[model samples]
Target: MTATPLIDPFQRTIDYLRVSVTDRCDFRCVYCMSENMTFLPKKELLTLEELDRMCSTFVGLGVKKLRITGGEPLVRRDIMTFFQRMSRHLDSGALRELTLTTNGSQLEKYADDLYAAGVRRINVSLDTLDDQKFADITRWGRLPQVMRGIDAAQKAGLRIKINAVALKGFNEDELFTMVDWCAERDMDLTFIEVMPMGDIGNENRLGQYWALSDLRDSLRERFTLTDLAERTGGPARYVRLEETGQKLGFITPLTHNFCESCNRVRLTCTGELYMCLGQEDMADLRKPLRDYPEDDRALENAIRAAIALKPKGHDFDYSRQKLDGQMPRHMSHTGG
Candidate 1:
């Protein structure tokens, strides 16, 4: 096999692609939706065939890692079929890692098939440990069931990772407790900085973008965090707590600009490829798919175009333009 040339906006070859299967989710998490948020029409979403073709083209273009995301990926009807087919493609070596990031509400029933299908890992978004708090934050708490999904994924032998967005008021109290939980089991606990992504001014207001560095500085006595080597996979910086052998990751997108080493491009649920979260500009991929029927040089060239256009980094992290009144499209939509 020949090497897929790496070419990113930062002069690095981009190899990561996050594909959003749908812009719809079952949960109405506070940060993700408004009291009156309307979902996208089914026809507006990328078809399974369109998605597979795009994934295959991008994989051929050197996207070694592909993450499936959704409003809730499993919320899509008959998602098992999608995974069964996608897994076969990923295993064929068009991609290196095929992973999914979900809310875990619907993973219990699908874990076995997903694992058997070739899905390599799972990242479950569970912010609060308290059931009521989880309910308050997610609106449809169902903490017990989500926990069940986590157990199911683990039992299925999926490389499970827990992603908790450490909101100052929501789950700030559980920061260390959560870390201890992951440390005890050696499961990776990732602290994702709440990003400004939507338009729900009141619900999505990022009033509490706490700095992880400060959180670490304050916890110097309890645990020592050692920085790990820089590698790009997800949007997090790696660090480990001393003596525990547990990985502690901080995705400080709001406070830190990690664009120099940025090597990712994203696909929206509607089949548009976004080069950066902050930029409104995107290449409308649905048109190309509608125009072309199969994976050809044109399709591969489009993937290359998207990769080559991958931004050096996002500038949205540091903009102080008062983010208390907006949320972009929700984490589920962008696969954050």
Candidate 2:
């Protein structure tokens, strides 16, 4: 049976769902969370079985692509079981893709298991390549560990994409170096503008904001970047490097909004459905799911209600030397 398609208020089909399985991570990235972080209580988080049911419900509602994320999704205990169960959606052709975004610290252990469970591609959040700089950025991440994980993933036949958060005065000097490095490894690279979210202990959001437009200009000096009209069901806009022939993507949520064509929604580890990443508006699906555990109708209706209130766009502007439209929750809380 064909499930009723999930269409938002703006007429965009909500087929992509990013689910945060846990709010805990081993590496506390400077941009994502504070060095000394307080994670969500385990009791408040949905159990792995609950997560499976919630995701399965979304799949029944026509969510074609599912991306498991977290502070580091691999850190979750027995997370492979969730992936193994979700693979049923793929086997039935109900889901097109099942992937995850990781910090790459745990891939060495989980990469083979991820492939066996149906994940063919993944996005690894790597801000810098320098070992010391990598440690400084991720706070607890070791570059060698991540590199080993990347090697394992590649060896396991999983496609890899490097996601780097473009920070001013930090990775600006490594622009060419990063691109060339990814190109050499045959991995696609994406540069994202720093979003204004949560408190980073002592770091200033405005100070770290790096406009992706400036970075694009810098890339133009070295490579012939021709804009490609292809979207991977997300906000990234792609460009092919004429020299290396590899694809480069730019996710400019601050400098350029990609909301008009937004076709996804984020589900937190606690089962809160966030209509927009930049907005605090969220619908508590947990209450509905837990209150009516055996009632699929109630869960479906609750999801539909949330989709109806999905905002047209996010208001994340970093202009005039100020950080406007900032959210109080950390990126790790909602899954970046």
Score every model by TM-score.
0.92, 0.98
Model 2 lDDT per residue over 3-49, tens place: 78999987999999999999999998888989888888888899999
- Could you say which candidate leads in lDDT? 2
Q: Model 1, 62-164: lDDT tens per residue? A: 7788888877888887767777777765667767888888999988889988889888688888888888988888886589999899888888888878888
lDDT score for candidate 2 against the true structure: 0.93
Model 1 RMSD in angstroms: 2.3
Task: After superposing candidate 2 on the true structure, give the runs of residues whose Cα lies further than 4 Å from its correct spot.
Answer: none
Q: What's the residue-level lDDT of 126 in candidate 1?
A: 82
Weakest lDDT window of 10 consecutive positions for candidate 1: 318-327
- How close is each model in CA RMSD to the real structure? 2.3, 0.9
